[model samples]
Target chain A: MASEIVVDKLVKRFGHATAVDAISFSVDQRETVGLLGPNGAGKTTTMRILAGLSPADGGTVQLAGLDARTQGREVRRLLGVVTQQDGLDVEISVRENLTVYGYLCGLSRQASATRADAVLTFFGLEGRANDEVDALSGGMKRRLAIARAWMTRPRIIILDEPSTGLDPHSRARVWENLAELKAGGVTVLMSTHYMEEAAVLCDRVAIMDRGRILALGPPRALIAEHAGRGAIEIRCDEAQRDAVRAALTAIAVPWREMGAVFSLPDEGADLGPVATLAGVQVHHRPAHLEDVFLRLTGKELVDD
Target chain B: MTEFRLRSVAGVVERHRVATVRTWKVALTWFLIEPAFVLVAMGSGVGQLVVEIPGHGPYSHFVTPGIIIGMVMFHALFDSAWGVFNRIQQGAFETQLTAPVTVTELAAGEALWGGIRGVISTLAIGGLAILLGWFPLSALPVTLLVSFVVGVQFGVVGLCSASASPSMSALTLVFTVMATPLFFFSGSFFPLEVLPDWVEPLAWIAPLTPGVHLARGLAEHSLDLSHALCALYLVAFTLLLFPVAARMLRARLVK
Candidate 1:
């Protein structure tokens, strides 16, 4: 894979507040990379700067070999963005919206109409093309937004939580579409908080917290590297709780205490301990990416 | 394949036109119906109270030129303020920021389009006045051109004001405080011939005062040529505001 994006030392400030404290990252061609972080973690700000929706105070961003500052038009031309919020026109029909976006990207009248029809069909919106965008359902709208982004035939596509605020069915469909995009050789970069979604979909993931990348690698590799053996959830009464903690610690297991639920991790290293804890009400489970993510970036909530 | 840079001004204008044209009933209501109401109400109620100028003819003669000037201000200010504010607040501005369109292009296109819409309404009112048998309606080409320029001048001012202000309410407040006063004090409704000298200085700065002067000049040759140079004053004011407004819009956006 080749690097499709290069962002180095990006900074942005609003008044006195540093929105994106100097940060850097890149995504490769034909790779589906995930940017995972909590809400207000500066993920959207970073993407916005990359998309040229806002200027970075200091940084260099090259997309498809075009420097964002010098060749912003070419940078914009090569990349497509599906913003966190749907930027659709409620007053226009679905087809018209697609055509307008296509036209804005320099598509000719005939080409725009044809592409709009194709995108509408691709997104399962062929029959609804003439209907107002406001009349579309949540899933339909999300699908439309994604489709609109596709009208440009971009080499690199950035999705900002493409499935945010969607119901289960809508989320599943969106994920499936994203998976299809990845399969078709389109480089996909996204920021999301859905732990399971990242684990299942991302070719590689970068776990971000407070504007910094804490951990990066394949999900299972991260789990195997940091989580030790797979995680084991145990429920013990007060009388035997100390014994379990002591036993786990004596064996050099890493654990997190959250109220009464204890999470002990061994991260795909050995299975002997699972057998030992089996009769002790310990349910040994395979360590998930969520486990790796939570381990690297502690689960404590930031100041709310 | 699509290009990386979007031609956003052309794109947005094309998009706006498509959307606006689709909603013809609503647009007509905006472009026609409401303006008709104002013209009828104002023309009928106040049209009876005035006498003709010594050489210009009927009272309605003065009213057409003045109403045209007033409509120019009303349409220009209203369109730019509400239009730009809505786009900025609604995230449409973000699209333009990402596109190939520069701030200058977007602002110019918006001001131009707003002026066009203003001109349309002004003409509608002008036609209504003629049908009601007001002015003798002599010259065509020159009057229309001058009126068009007047609309553009005011439209630029409105665009600059809207882009510089933080909120739509502030735009409205500024209009009420500065614009409305200028409209009345400029001697549009009543001639300034008999007014006290103290109020003379204030009228000098009123844009519509220059606007009215030019309009009257175009309509009737009796209003004096040197006085119509006031319109040139408006032209200079518009020229100065263009770059200032573009810079403000650039800063306000792309944040």
Candidate 2:
């Protein structure tokens, strides 16, 4: 499939701090890609540039085959962007929100009303159609925000932290909605910090930090390449730390430290020497993107 | 060749309409109570102390037009400046800009809504004036037209102010410094000729002065070359400020 969104050598700067350093990536039509990173990791900045809400300091973005810079009006018509803030008019009804966006996209009065109803039903917001946005729970408001974006029938949607601040059930519902969108073949480029969300929802994931893509590929492939088959976690006392480090180095295995716990890639290596250390506990578990992120940055994924 | 989109402008207006309608009890109460209280208290209560004025027959007649124009300017300025500032802070325009709407359209829609609000205020206060026999029923059409012009004028001013204001307190300060002076000095409740010679020039230059003059002339059946000039002044002010307001909002919103 042709690339639906292509970003090349994108750079964004805010005074002395670079928000999005020179980076390049693309999302093909009907494919979902996630930009996974911690806070201030340039994900929102990148999504904003692609949505045409902010200017890029350098480089280019193409959405649905239209240049985001030169053909912004055309590009915007094919794009639906949900920023981190839901940005709903809390004073209005849930249905009115969708209709307003429909009209903004140049739908006729009758068409906008029809589309509003359609999207409300599709997003399971029809039951709350007449309710004021302020009266709804946080999850309903987020769903309405997405439904409003979908009202324009956009070919591609850009969401920044779509499921942030939601309970597990609400997050699952949002995920199911997104999965349906993907099933219907809408291209999606989303930014998220949740490892499980990216792992489950995205066809490919780009791990980013400090304005750079640290790694980009399928989730399983990235795990295999960076974290190996599993992770061996060893918790030891401060006194034995030096000896434990020496024992692991003598065996030549890659490892990362988090407080008293040392996590090493569970390659089938001899670990009897390290296991025999005094006052040390050892265990093993399946590898995940958290381990990959830790292995790549030597920093905890949830730190930032 | 034009970037202006009428549909987008209409969309924004519709949103504002829906918002106003949803809180119609509050709006209706404002429409009936605020203007009626101001007009009756100033027209009857204060008019008794003054009795009459030269060139215009009664104090009631002289002040009615002033009150109508004042109400129009007040509604337009409040809805555009303060309302726009609140919406910007809430990131409302960010959602609209993601669609096929342009910044120019958004500005135009806001100005148009301001005009609508001005018209509503005018009808309320002008209706009270007609019932009280302070204004002629024949002048309603021209009065509404003038109200719309003045509304557009102040709407642009409000947009410019909101775009430049850095914080809510800063916006309040701007309004206190700018709007309060304009309201008091624009010949709204009294003639500029009675003020000190130095203050007269300053009062005449207040942006609301032209709208007051034109509205008063139409309501009193005293239209002249000066009234035409007042209309021209209002039109020129709107034309000059509209693009500046749009550009300022674009700078703040699209960054």
What are the Cα lDDT values of the candidates? 0.73, 0.87
TM-score of each model's B chain? Answer: 0.85, 0.97
The TM-scores of all predictions, comma-separated, are: 0.85, 0.93
Stretches of candidate 2 above 4 Å error?
A: A235-279
Q: Candidate 1: DockQ?
A: 0.42
| Cα lDDT, model 2, residue A121 | 94
Instruction: List CA RMSD, all candidates.
Output: 4.7, 2.8
| Most accurate candidate by DockQ | 2
A276 in model 2: Cα distance from truth in Å? 6.1
Q: For residues B1-255, what per-residue lDDT tens digits would candidate 2 score against the true structure?
A: 337778889988988898899889998766768888888888899899988888877888888888888887778888788888888887777888898878889999999988888888888878878988999999989889989888888888888888999998988965689877777789877889999998898887788899889888887898899888888888998999899999999898887
Off by over 4 Å in 1: A232-282, A300-304, B1-8, B53-56, B135-140, B143-147, B164-168, B222-228
Error of 1 at A179 (Å): 2.8
TM-score of 1: 0.85
